[model samples]
Target: MKNLVALLLLSLLYLHGTTSLAEDINSDAETLPAFCTSYKCPRYQLIKKYEKFEHRIYNATNWVTTSLKLDFLGIGLAKSFKRLLDYINGKNSEGLVMKMTVPVRIKVPRSDILSTNATMSFFVPPAVDTLPTPLNPDIYVEQLPEISVYVRSFGGYALNSDYEKQAKILVEELEALELSYNSSYGTAAGYNDPLTFFNRHNEVWYMAL
Candidate 1:
């Protein structure tokens, strides 16, 4: 099912054009730093760059997300991604089929090694006039407020270990610089499809305090 969903998303990408699904978003691509590979990404400003991390301010945007507790990151992400994908694939109150977005966001709270409270999210396109209610009980539309974050970017494919390693490095760098951040939680964002094999973009984020 995941593979099928990914194929469908790729098809959507081809049909809408690789860069954008809307003209308004395409106009701003040159002006702002794009975090996602294709389609529209959440609007953000690059505030500053540090030796090991970057500081950014992002505007609030709505997302379709699903809560999942990780017993294993791979399995958990698969489940959550599927649920969110289904929601955007005409499995909603209004049966909407929207363009796929990049940089899937996963929020995680600090906790045990194997298990943590986490939720996976996909950016909601501004083109969506009235966001449809999710048919799946586990999925919901959420709005994130504008916020500041300390971010670290890395290349290649990311898994549980990759994100954890990046987060550790990010935290260490922040503490060394005497930066203030919420130690309780952070997020990881991936800007590629599962089929994307090279030049994959990934980042771990720590919310600034």
Candidate 2:
């Protein structure tokens, strides 16, 4: 009876160890970006990781965009968001309702402290081919080529001021590391909506040279 009981204990220990090992392997093999969990978002290849930013190569994709020229980034973003939201909500020629995608993007100017002459864009999902025409004259579809960028992520309820401050920090870090990047403009990407009060994610991207 003693020997049998000892064998059962050893079998249990071995099983537990195997389970732990499998879990660890799965954890390491995770490839999806954390912020992409809630919706369909673009995927990228992680080229390198630094103390301040990550270098990634994103594939070519399509987007629906609208132009904005406002000194107040916050207000402009709100207006643009509503416009794009309408587009996905069947405000197009085809009247086809589309699902919302992740990471609303703003092509912000790096030369100025304020975000002026920006373009707000929503990513077109991979499944979409032959986009519908926008009812709004200002809204149009554009193709973005595959490109590499330096990305810095932060968590908070991001406002205009928040993005500006983070952009400065990201630039400083890149300069400190002697990295080459485009100075003319950067992209601000937000993963959460305004209603999401907690654990919000945002990113600043500089085009890699």
Candidate 3:
């Protein structure tokens, strides 16, 4: 009888553990911020009111790379786009393909972004362009109207291991504020650098906000 009782307790414990894990995953998924909820996000505000840029779907596939200086983001993105094009053309089969929106929103603080000191997550974007049959030199950087996003700020840079910790903090904040969010929001990039930044660094977390 004692053995049976112990066995039953163990079963219950295992079930509880599985349930807890599932809950954590669900909670993380649901913590996604609203679209362009930032004061500094001009693109977000512009789209919110004017809808000047019609929403168009695009594709993207991102891989992890270290951005130790933050300055490399814009250039990195350009390279990534080049890679993405290569993949589409069957040049690189190792890369992944994904779908996202164009004119994607970016987030910084209400004050100067350099002073924001927050972890950022940006959307990996893809867009179609009208390059003449010969391909024009001026239509290189595709124009995308920006959208809105929700944001939660954090301090310090970190490695991949720190995602759960930061995500949990954002999750708690979202829940505390009773915000409505999507379950699809998940971690993409883990590191960012600022020294090479031509645009910004505090622009780190660009999830579905």
Candidate 4:
């Protein structure tokens, strides 16, 4: 009788452990970054990881972008986001409401003197063949070739200054490695909802020359 009681207790403990582990896995899946769940986002393989940088090879991707030629980065981004959101909300010629993707990318020129114009882009999902024509003339679609890039990632809310600082760090690391990269252009990628307060993912990407 004692042995049977012992066996029963062990079974109960085993079931409890399994249940807890399953719950933990479900919680983790629910908390995955938006970038990982989006099929439209660029696919990349991590080639190298450094203390402050990562080298990656990214596959070719299609994008829908809007150009905002404003002096301030924040203002330009705001306008671009508004325009792009409208496109995704069915403000297009086909009146199609596109799926929202993660890691909204912004490209900036790489001059010491800041440029007035910047391009903000969203990834086009694979199933979207009949591309919607943007009602706004400033928005357009383009297919980009596969490229290799070095990236620096950071947490929390991303501001222009944060991106600039991280980009500088990546450049220094690349120099240390004797790597050549395109200095004329770079991209900033954001991978979190606006309301996310912690563990936010932001990255600055520089193309390999």
Candidate closest to the true structure, highest TM-score: 1
Residue ranges of candidate 3 with Cα displaced over 4 Å = 1-42, 46-82, 85-147, 187-209
Top-lDDT candidate index: 1
In candidate 1, what are the lDDT values of residues 1-209, reduced to their tens digit? Answer: 00101112222233333332333423333433444655677778889999888999988888998886565325565677778777776789987777677667877677544444567788886667678999999998997799998999987766666777888899899999899999877787777765667777788888999
Alpha carbon deviation, residue 167, candidate 1 (Å): 0.8
Model 4 spans > 4 angstroms off: 1-40, 112-116
Q: Candidate 3, residues 57-151: lDDT per residue as tens digits? A: 22233221211111212332343333323332222222333322121222222233232221222233222122112122211222334423333
- TM-scores for all predictions: 0.81, 0.79, 0.31, 0.77
- Stretches off by above 4 angstroms in model 1 are 1-35, 114-116
**Which ranges of candidate 2 are over 4 A from the true structure?**
1-31, 113-116
Error of 3 at 158 (Å): 2.7
Error of 2 at 207 (Å): 0.5
Show the colliding residue pairs in model 2: none
State which candidate, 1 or 3, has the greater TM-score.
Answer: 1
How many Å off is the CA of 188 in candidate 1?
1.0
Q: Rank the candidates by lDDT, best first.
A: 1, 2, 4, 3
Q: For residues 1-209, could you state the per-residue lDDT of candidate 4 as single tens digits?
A: 00000011111122122211111111212232354443246667788888888888877777888875534434445667778777876789987776566567777777522355567788775556667888999899888888888888877676656777777788888889888998777787876654456666778888887
Q: Against the true structure, what is every candidate's RMSD? A: 6.0, 17.3, 20.6, 16.6
Scored by lDDT, model 2 comes in at 0.69
